[model samples]
Target: MLIYLSIISIASILCLWSEKSYKKGELFLSGFSTFLSVMVLSVFSGLRNLSVGIDITTYGKNIFETVSTFGPSVAIDYYSRWADTGYVLFNYIVSFFTGNIHIFLGVSTFVVELSFLLFFKRYRAVLDPTLSFFIFNVVTLAYSFSILRQILSMAIIIWVYYLLTKGKYLSAILLAVGSVLIHKSAVFIILIIFTCYIITKFKEKINQRYLLLLMILFTLLSTIILTRYPETIDNLIDDLNISSIQLNNFGSPMRFILFLFPVLLIKILIKEKFIQNNEEYFLYLISLITMSFGWLGGINYSLTRLTYFIIPIYILFISKKLKIINKKSINLIIIFWFFFIFWWLIGRGSEGGVIPYIPFWKEYIVF
Candidate 1:
């Protein structure tokens, strides 16, 4: 617990420093702080004991060992049976240099954090990247610690968004495909990207209120269908040959509340006219879509994970708009998030299997 809290505390200070530097137009100082913040987290994540995340012991080390023992081609061929080809290839490529699992973990986390930093920088005009990074650590990074492949896929998808925003469509398209190759679940996010494109293309005709209502209605209807015929979802997954995925009857009420809070916050931003242009409105819509996925967690608990892809989006959205909110309100919001993150980090570390944090050095007795 000391290790975990100390890491977050130090990173949080750097995040604050970064935000202050940016506000003062000290670009170099801000960038340095931002880089340091990310590196601090990335290094900690990379150097954690192999037993830290459940998946590390269950699959990560196995795949790393396979590549080290039998070479890349055989390891790739063997794991490709059930694992993602891109992920296997990634492991093999990383294994090619050194078989140290710690190196692989560090490198993978650096990629994820770098992609996220780029995404935040792309929207820096509308967001405080430092604040967004802090929220990401509290809300999403723990899960990333465990779900390595999907998190890599998530990073690639986020990079795709960054590329698209920069008008680099060819690169974006290639990376979009790459994300799916890394994890099939990325197909949902690809659909989201396509839907967002359609929404943006027709922004003049799209009614944000009506679209939001429709999304809420759809979520409610999905919940009913899931409750009435749970087997329908099961059968669909089975037919898709993804029986590896499991289903749950209902999601946690705490999660429902957490997801709903963001929707309400977005509505407040819209009501206050904080969303001034089509681009901002489009961001609002994407935030709505992201939160709605969490609402539909009633359909399958796993559906909640779909929201992970948009963590950067909604965080950027809120950070951008919250500037208009009163300082007291902002403080309240921060307090809410602090409590939520505390509960999540302390109460449910087991969920991500990232608790009882152990540094790799200690685990290996190298110190």
Candidate 2:
């Protein structure tokens, strides 16, 4: 726990330095600081023992061993049966170099961190990069340690979103397909993005207030309907042929409230005219709609994972809002995040067992 906290403290200071350097027009210093910030967390995450994350020990390790053992020739059939093609292929490719699971995990962590670094770079103008990076570290990075494949998929979807904003439609579509190939869960995210995109086009035709209300109503209705008639969820999962995810687990209202908090902050920012352009507003709408899926957590906690893909954009939106909001409100928001981070990392059973922070090399000796 102390190691994790220390990493966060170090990252926070580095990000602040990056922001200060950027303000002073010191591009090289700013970029180097950002790189150092990413490396700090990445190195720590990469060096962790396989015992650090539940999935890494079981499914993650098992899959890597299977692929590396059978060699790349088995990838096609193996992936077709039980695993995501891209992720399995990744394991196969990594097998060519080294059979060490630690090395594979380190590479995976670096890739995930690189994706986030690119995301932060793309949105630097719209947000305080310091806050964006910090929020990601606090809110999402730990989860990546456990759910490697899904987080990698989410990272690809972040690129998809970035491309879409740049009007690179074909490229975005191709990358979205690749993202789904990495994790089937990405299908839900793609659907959400398409729905949001369509709505964004018609947003001017409809009143913003009513559209917001409609989204809220949709969230409420969906949650109530799914919970009351769970068969609806089961049947849909059957039809979709996606039985990999078990929606049986449920989450508390506090989790839902945490997801909702940012939406409310975005709403406040909207009223304050902080949404100066269409792209920012579009991301705001996507953030709200994505978070609305959090309400469905009552039905199946797995349903909430859909919100993960939206997190990068959500962080950027919230950071921008925080930048523009009053200092008192900012302090309150920071306090809330600190409390939430403790609750999530500590109160939530160490969040995939990332508490002890044992380096892989020292695992046997320390234990």
- Which candidate comes out best when scored by lDDT? 2
- Model 1 reaches what TM-score against the true structure? 0.83
As for candidate 2, its clashing pairs are none
Give each model a TM-score: 0.83, 0.84
Q: What is the C-alpha local distance difference test score of candidate 2? A: 0.69
Clashing pairs in 1: none
What does candidate 1's lDDT look like per residue over 1-367, in tens digits? 4465567668868877877898899989988987887788889888888877756863588887897778667766766534367887788788878788887888888778878776776666766665666666667776677788878988888777666666788998999889887877778788877677666656585576786786677667777887787675554222222222223322445555665575576456558575566666666777777667666653464564567777667776777766556355664676467457545533353445566777876874421
Best by TM-score: 2
Q: Per-residue alpha-carbon lDDT of model 2 for 215-247, expressed as tens digits?
A: 789788887887688676554332322233222
